[model samples]
Target: MSIHRLIVKSAALLTAGIAIGALLAGAAAAQQKLSFLAAEYSAKTLPFWEQVVADFEAANPDIDVTLEVVGWNTIHDLTAQRIAAGTMPDLVNTATIWVPEWVDAAAIRPLGDDLVDATLRADFVPALFDKGAVYNGENWGLPIAAAARAILLNKGLLAQAGFDPDAPIATWDDYRSIIVGVKEKTGAFGYAFDAKGVRAFRDFGYYLLNNGGTFFAADGRAAFNSPEGVEALQFLVDLVKAGAVPDPLGTTLEDYQPMYEAGRVATMINGNFAIAGIKANAPGLEIAVAAVPVKTAGQTPVTWGVTDTLVIGKAAPVEASRKFIAHIFSTAVRNQFDEAEGMLPVLLSQAGNPAFTGDPNIKAFIDMLPTSQFDPFHPQYAQMQELVKTAMQSAITGAASPKDALDKAAADFNALVK
Candidate 1:
């Protein structure tokens, strides 16, 4: 009853403890963990994703999800660092234009029937899903958010400029007259011209596309130096020279957004998401939403439709990641995310949801979807965009004429494509 019994009991307890520890470790190893790198859409973005992660974890106890939200400006660099470090996230949200590069690098996996079933693929808005998420004839991603550009007019400034606050600007001539009138009468910038950074190409695109110009021709050659492109660039340059916009050489959309919200800018071209920002920042400011006026009457209105995509990394735990992707792409989740971020829904099922249909600002963007054109999703398109930005800055600063600047850009773009 003394030494022998004590030693046996001690050994038995030690064996039990080890067995329990091994079982616990195995259980922990059985749970799948996934990492998500989301590009920040707004202040609400992180919080919304946090809630989604919480809900997903609660519903799927066997899967663990971690969310990291980075600003749009830094996501690309951060993602590249993660890839180089061999620690890529299971899922990532990136600008749709960047998909081609990621595909070219083989950094992401294609979402085939195994990941995205036919039913799920069919639910996405065709224009967005087909054009934005497809690369090299494969579905590479899903559109996380979509937006279409439109013009926002300050009604008070329009009235001050002796134009009907509710009148539609039907042609470029009418729009130009209002731009000059607003500056002359109110001494406020008539149009907010963003001529710096990546967005400069977007600004130029509005004019170029509306004027029947395109980034590439039918043969996939650079066509931005065509007469239509030159005319559009000249229009913007002329506006800059006439004092219709402020500091076109130095300003960007981020700089002008606040000025517009403060009612110091008369008009600006912005995505439908701007309505939410304007409402939040300047609740009392009266605003009017209008189509970007055509180059001439009857030319048909065009808008830029942009989408940010959600992709799965090649190194991801495919089963767990696919389950999560399907969960988020469901109609209810998609609607909530789009509403919170003030983005147009990428899901066709959510297009007619009351939350979107009830808002005129959202309706306007939806209406423009028919005539919307997206950026070229080429591997070198980012470089081409930078070249275009350089030309825009040169033209705006009077360092070169619009035609000359664009001609040089076109040459560089052709070389890049070749």
Candidate 2:
């Protein structure tokens, strides 16, 4: 064998090895794709998620993303069904309320040290994260948006009643007096409530908390039978009996908006999304918001704050899905998401951004976060709401006593949890 022959053979082998390595790298890049499932198959979910995807893709240049817009109606149930059928997406959007149940079911993975940003964990509200991610002592998801139900008071009506328009009704008694006085002076309904439904009662979860009771105990037992719970329900019921609420017209959260527009109802309790309807219904009406009035003299006021969370499903390709989840939580992407949806931002710094700050009504939702309680953490919360709704309907219609109705509800809920 000649020296020239040996040298040529070695060079050829090295060149082939490098070409193979390049091919493998190219294939790996092509195979990396992240998929997301969001509530509402509409522009609200996609535009924001896509913005983040675009930014991430530009920076990485090697990953592809697919975004699926899911409707709120069936997203959670469908996601679970699909995962059971072996076809879950990489990531899913769920109400933060479900974090406990989902994590308990072992239907999701723990996001370890890999994806969480220390700064975000520190800067973001711990309560928000505890409600959204830390369930059963584990972090399961990222809180995307923070929202609370607020009392939408008619400043015009308060003024007509000779009350201070700028001062918030500080207690349940104050709210009652103001509403009754307004109706007497204006010939309008004192308060507009969801006359025949559960939201009126369900919305009182805040009142329950402030009064020292929860819909469910941390042990998953029904706690609505407590005195605080009964008193909360009676607060709304007494308002009805006093002719404060309009005719038991069997209304909903949406129904009261029109009444306010017609100058027939003084105030109502609802969420940030309700602002659009109010503005449209009563463009000229002076409106303001405040926290739900506290139930007791010493009780700290609380409100129902809902969160939309991003969770990686059990069937997700955990490593790749986490990268996409973490990417969505980036500061720039979060601001874009809240701005597009008209939702209060979750990032501590972006809370007061002019884009969302222009509406003071939104601030009520953001402000309630400190004393807000997430929905009952039971997996069967939907069932519990239904049972409570039924019981309250019976109670309001004289078919049962509030105490009896709630006692029965507690029994039913206990059975469900069992």
Candidate 3:
């Protein structure tokens, strides 16, 4: 070959190599990074998120996602610490109650119609999405996990107490009779009452709502100390007085699982997830689920519907984070998540899935969705919940009468609202 031709070919090769390197560098620079802080719902929570991230990354090579799963107990503190340090994650899974606080702090961005299209928004269970994810006329988060509360009865214990396990408890009076009977006959605690922890207010809430009580009146004043509220608390206090529950002042909902599994308690009010735990820990135990008893036979039955949501940080790359959110909210991914966590489906599309419909436990909870109620969304709900817990504890431990305890709580809650 001629020397000139050889020189030209070599120069052309060098130019091509430089162009290729520049393109590779540009691709790396264009890649978007998203960090997700997820609450650990169970042991499977981390593994499930890991698979999701892997799958998302494979499909969108230009967007990289980092996932960190923490227990429900610690996720709030961890998120707060991150926020204080100015290192907030791009996405966070949090309880719906906390959304108001996060919104007030301007920590998260409202998910407008542009981010969550009409089709995707329509797919969510309307009751859950409207009640939980929407705050102040705007959608602020995506409902990721949900559970409906129910009464879980031990068939063996009820039978031993001479009550048919299949009998429906249509009124509070009937429920009281059965629990009292179980306590007197079987010597097992009739009810597993939880009165400790941040969520202890839920125990009282069960009775409060059933008896036509609301935490706050329409005018935003504290109304939990009304006649109905006092009656509800008194009923629970009487149960404690009658020794129908064990250590009402000391036990949290989590504490009741083992006792229930061991057949030490006749009945307990808990979410559908508890059914999964009981079955896994005590496979031989016969469990019966029923609607929470109401104040009267003709009154409607109400159950607590709780949901945890996904929110995007204000500083996040909104477009990329939204893509990740959309991917996880897909019916296929959501069905797996709900099944693994023993939670009801938050998406309407999953309501008909055979995996959920075929499972009687899930069906029981699902059946209660029509009458489900959620916690009031207030900026100071956490503080209000603490006040409610303290009031219940005070009443249960004889520090004060149910009326006085609730009155004090109501006064304190009103002060906060003002």
lDDT by candidate, in order shown = 0.86, 0.74, 0.87
Cα lDDT tens digits for candidate 3, 69-122: 999889887887887788889899999888888888788889876567788889
Model 1 earns a TM-score of: 0.93
State residue 175's C-alpha deviation in candidate 1, in Å: 1.0
Report the lDDT tens digits of candidate 2 across residue range 138-255: 7787787766788887888888888886687678888889878887898888777664554555655656776778888878888887998888778767777887777554787567
Model 2 stretches astray by more than 4 angstroms: 1-29, 41-43, 50-61, 195-201, 247-249, 356-359
Rate residue 370 of model 1 by lDDT. Answer: 94
Q: Give per-residue CA lDDT, model 1, range 203-317, as digits (tens).
A: 8888888888888886666788899898998999889888889886778888999999887899999988888888988999888888887798778678888999998899888
TM-score, one value per model: 0.93, 0.84, 0.92
Best by lDDT: 3
- Candidate 2 displacement at residue 244 in angstroms: 2.9
Per-residue lDDT value at 384 in model 3: 78
* Best first by lDDT, ranked: 3, 1, 2
Candidate 1: stretches off by over 4 Å: 1-21, 218-221
Best by TM-score: 1
**Per-candidate count of clashing residue pairs (backbone under 3 Å):** 0, 1, 0
* Model 1 steric clash pairs: none
